[model samples]
Target: MINFESQNLICRFRGIVLQSILWNNDVKSTKYTIKEMIAHHSCLELPEGKSITKADTLEDLAQLYELDDYYWAVKNIHPLTHDLNYVL
Candidate 1:
């Protein structure tokens, strides 16, 4: 993990890309990933304090969105978005 030490903090979404998926299934299966931006809320943790000790009390807030299904989660993976799951 990379560590940063700066009082003047700045963070931005570098955006997400399908990095690499060598092995997905338990038997190590390769599958073509289809990613489309479905309209929904996506919560991201604004960069935390320089050290872990200065973090907030609720870690849940970081992953919790206002409404999005949070596609990253296992249960929510297939149904990427809740109401609006279709590709635009």
Candidate 2:
């Protein structure tokens, strides 16, 4: 079990490193726009919740924005924006 966990961690780390390298290359090449990056990150489906309804109120709007920001920060390669050191 420990071996499996270690392997998973290593794989995930490699993926992150690869993603960072790709992002760096994109930044250098100017091939990827910030909007495209944001859109890519926002493609994830939110969890089932009443706050996600179309008829949601202003409070829901705030919550939704917060959720999007949190999701982007977590999925982003930058360490400063991430709340935790490790990926979820």
Candidate 3:
């Protein structure tokens, strides 16, 4: 696993070319923060001040995604937006 400093954060989204198997809802395939996506798909909790390492490049993200089905293309988004969504 790549070690990451908390200063840099990365996100992901399912590639448009991948077909959604379940529903016709394309909304479910929209870009999502990697942290949120991982939290939902795995029991592992991200460290309090750590983020995915080597996620700075698309190649890295693709390799990470290949390791597990939880990842997708790299996306950059606000870290706190997940919490704000819950509050709103």
TM-score of 1: 0.14
Q: Tell me the lDDT of model 2 at 43.
A: 29
**Residues 9-78, model 1: lDDT tens digits:** 1122101111111111211111111111111112122222121223221122223211123324433344
Model 2, 18-54: lDDT tens digits are: 4433333222222123223323544213331222334
lDDT, each prediction: 0.21, 0.36, 0.33
Highest lDDT: which candidate? 2
Candidate 3 displacement at residue 67 in angstroms? 10
Superposed model 3: Cα runs more than 4 Å off: 1-32, 44-51, 67-88
What TM-score should be assigned to candidate 3?
0.27
Q: What is the C-alpha lDDT profile of model 3 across 1-88, one tens digit per residue?
A: 5445222233223342122211222322322345455556543345421323324433333444352232232122222333322343
The TM-scores of all predictions, comma-separated, are 0.14, 0.26, 0.27
TM-score ranking from best candidate downward? 3, 2, 1
Residue-level lDDT for 19 in candidate 1: 17
